[model samples]
Target: MKAAVLRAVGAPLTVEEVDLSGPGPNEVLIRVVASGVCHSDLHVMEGVLPYPLPTVLGHEAAGVVEDVGPGVSALRRGAHVVVAVVPSCGRCRLCLRGRPNLCTAIRGRPGVMADGTRRLRLPGGEEVNHFTMISSFAQFAVVHEAAAVPVREDIPLERACLLGCGLLTGWGAAVNRARVAPGSSCVVLGCGGVGLGIVQGCAVRQAEPIVAVDLWPQRLEVAARLGATHTLLAGQEDVPALVRQLTGGGADYVFDAVGSPQTAALALSCLGRGGTAVLVGVGQRDASLSVPITATVLNERAVLGCDYGSAWPQRDIALLADMYAAGRLKLDELVDRTYPLEGVNEALADLKEGRALRPVILPWGDS
Candidate 1:
């Protein structure tokens, strides 16, 4: 099987004929159909996030099952599924407590299976690492049955792939983590794929005066198209003050999809009394946020860290798929373009250059 492998940090992914292992017990083998290249993957390539080298990088994907391993009664051959990055083990305390997004079993790191073993190999039998345990950069993948979340066959896998990560992160942030209430005011910092999802989620919850902030006017325009009541091009004016004015005093919530100390500070200033700031983006590996202590105590403001939008993948991924079918979620619009597996680096370049929003990788036979 052909796959894009990151042999070193700050290097381009090399497409090679890699060897993939069959699914073990309670696992499923999927023929990769559509996979979304996320910013998180870019972070790994740029060394913004430290990851093991020689790994296949891709997490957001939807595919069809080719075979099922032992103890995999929940899925079978020909079943369509979305691959979840966080394959929560139900027996873990976090999963049992309804917080599978923070499942402790995997320990929030990838490159290995649940049993902590590599399933990929080079030509000479050198072990290759897996990214997020759902390396969909290849033509096929072997994942735990729990990672293969079933969706209605009616929905196209190309769009459904976004629900695996970006869309799910944004949706879960607004609806689950933030618990956005109807008529509430929201300020979304960043209008990338995930930020747009947050805007749509807020819209579904009836959030009034949705203010979207982004450095790109093009993205802001798309944000407006997808339920943003107002769009602010970052650095033009006092964005914090404008957010307060648009929300009729101050925003009830501010979601910083561009994770950084700068954006965190901006979010801190865009909040009302008792408002919350949810950091949803992945910044540098050593990034740290500095919150104002006095203001936080006096104004009762909060700074919350969001991991994949605090999502329980099984439930939220399916719900997002349904929401899209119901015309409430914007999936097709979020996809800026599609690329072949060999064009993985170009896809990442487009995203980094702001030429695309959410680029999906397809099996264009260049693999």
Candidate 2:
């Protein structure tokens, strides 16, 4: 199978015909249809997040199940599914408590079945690691059955791919983590794909006076079209002050989708008394965010981190799918452009330019 391999940090990806193994027990082999170029992948490429090099870098994806391994009963061949980055051990304490996204037992290892062996091999017979436990960048991927969520047949594979990451992260932050109530005021920092999802999520729940913030005017425009009741330029000297003014003091909930200390701090400040601030973005490894301990105590502000929108694949995927089917969640408009696998660099360039909402990579035939 041909895949875009990240051979080194700060280097261009090379296309290579790699060898992929068949599925093992509890694993599913998927024929990759489409994958989204996410910022996390770029982070890995640029060394923002440290990981093994020569790994296939893609997590947000959707495809058709070509085969399922022994003991995999929930899925069948030819079934349409979206691959999740967070592979849960189902019996873990977090998964048992209804928080599968927090399950970390399956991470930090090479891409192998639970037996600890490599699945994909290079042409020279060397083992190549998979990224995010999904590695949807390749022509085919071997993912755990728990990581593959079955989606409706009617939904386009490209749109369903977004739900695996950006959509779930944004929507889950609003509905699950922050639990923003209807008729409440909220502010979403950064109007990128995830931020836009947060905006739509807030709107779907009827969160009144949704404030969208971003430096780019185009994203602000898209955010308004999606669900933002109000848009902020994000060019002001003090964003927190602007947010407070827009919501008449402060918002009931604030979301930081950019994941930087600056944006996280701003989101924390945009919250009203007793309001909650959810940080959904992953910051740099050495980066740390500081907050006023006195101010947090005085105003009773709560700051929290949201992982994968706290999504439970089996249930949340279906929930978002139903929302998309019912027109409550907008997926088609979220796509900015599509690129062939060979044009992955162009797609990443578009992403860095802040010119794309969600750039999807159509592996082969879709292009």
Query: What lDDT tens digits, residue by residue, belong to model 1 across residues 86-164?
Result: 8788888888888899886753356787778878999999999988888899899988898999999999898899999
Q: List the global CA lDDT of all models.
A: 0.88, 0.86
lDDT for predicted candidate 2 compared with the true structure: 0.86
Candidate 1 clashes between residue pairs 3 or more apart in a chain or in different chains: none
TM-scores for every predicted model? 0.97, 0.96
For residues 1-367, could you state the per-residue lDDT of candidate 2 as single tens digits? 8898988899988878999997987889999999998889888888999887678888999999999999999999999999887878889899999899999876657444455666888989888887877787878998888889999999899889999999889998999888889998999998887898899889988998999999999999999999898888887547778778878889999999998888887887788888888988886977678988997999998998898988887888888888899887898888978888888888887887898888998887574
Where does candidate 2 stray beyond 4 Å? 108-114, 236-238
Count of steric clashes across candidates, in order: 0, 0
Q: The CA-based lDDT of model 1 is what? A: 0.88
Cα displacement (Å) at residue 322, model 1: 1.2
